[model samples]
Target: MQRSLLLRCSNSIFRPPPNSHRLRPPSLKRQSAPIAASSGAQLPLTFSQNYRTAPNRLHCSVSESQWKQDREMATADEQQDPRIARISSAIRVIPDFPKPGIMFQDITTLLLDTKAFKDTIDLFVERYRDKNISVVAGVEARGFIFGPPIALAIGAKFVPMRKPNKLPGEVISEEYSLEYGTDKMEMHVGAVEAGEHALVIDDLIATGGTLCAAVKLLERVGVHVVECACVIELLGLKGRERLGDRPLFVLVNST
Candidate 1:
């Protein structure tokens, strides 16, 4: 029964109904404890367990209606933002990209549209501007694209959280789980100082593993991560839940 429910949830996320641009919320609720595996079954490792073990985490209890209303208000706000439409339309979806059973949200197309790309950065800048954000920590690769511009616009330093030995100086690293193994994200030791306000930037949030790792990396150095911002969010994955009390801001929800 559990397997069936998991399969159904996956299907609902990746296989939306025809003519549907928005995804309906999945029916499966999140389990508090890890599900027990059947005999001889090997369960995949997840980052949620590790995230929960961290100290001083803030937990909130929000009612379902309140959560829905908050989401609705956010959506309405996006609708009012002129950049939202252009950013959403410029993104291209490629089926079975990088692997089968994946519907990849491609942002390269958005990069090609100069106006849309600028609008994307401008939207982020508007939010962080005058918020006293001093450090913009961008996760590797795609984060590199959006982070620099926002950092420059907001008069903040751009810190790169890279993979493995990408950085030349002394660095600190945080590792997170993958399907078959684990991966690490590293940051320069002195790139940011204690008590500095930070904002984490990434292109997308699926299972939240990368963003979670980024947060942990920043926090280790005593940086206060104001919030995480992504270009697109896969709503069915419930990545927001993995972030605990850290708020997430996104321009598009590809449910």
Candidate 2:
């Protein structure tokens, strides 16, 4: 049954019901608010507030009015961008997942859509392809999914920041705090050298702990982190603030 549902969803990737486009929430828009990065520059990218209700509820505490004004600011051009709508619609939101009161932004559905998955990598590649990035570091697990394609597309070497005991080599580690306890991320020794610029890629950002640890690990090895990028950002959690000055760039914002 689960497999059939996924297959149906995948098959309908490019076909939407008549006037379905009109029902899509506000299109993507560039954020006026600056997200600080290593260069102290602002990224001109889309930022939208996504609010989902019952059937596929979002466990967000914030009210919708607070973000309604921002949604209204979306430009006509942004609203017309097919990639934004396609990508946004492909994501599957699961309520009470992994525990109660949690809204998980599942990208497995998005991955099943060939065009959507390619667009995901294309967007990141278009942003970093000419930025002189030498290394692309991906956090364990999900990061392993989105990182390699972007790394390969941008002509950069892929570095995996793994969980403890996963890397079979001399490694360096950084311990980070989690909601329940603490965890550590390890990187192979000498994988990156001084004077190299890196971009950290992950699937999503909630509290930003994992990305922070990845940044710290790379910086500890004298690598200059260019910025951190993710496919989704849970605005309600304010994970962006946890990264300090390292800038964060994301494709979709959810609450």
Top candidate (TM-score): 1
Q: Score every model by TM-score.
A: 0.74, 0.72
Candidate 2: worst-modelled 10 consecutive residues by lDDT: 1-10
Per-residue alpha-carbon lDDT of candidate 1 for residues 137-183, written as tens digits (9 for 90 to 100): 99888999999999999999999999998999998999987655788
Summarize candidate 2's per-residue lDDT along 80-157 as a digit string, tens digits. 566766676677665335553344567898898899899888888888999899999998788899999999888999
Q: What is the lDDT of every predicted structure here?
A: 0.68, 0.66
Residue 233: error of model 1 in Å? 0.8
Candidate 2 has an lDDT of 0.66
Q: List the residue pairs that clash in candidate 2.
A: 36-247, 37-247
Worst 10 residues of 1 by lDDT: 1-10
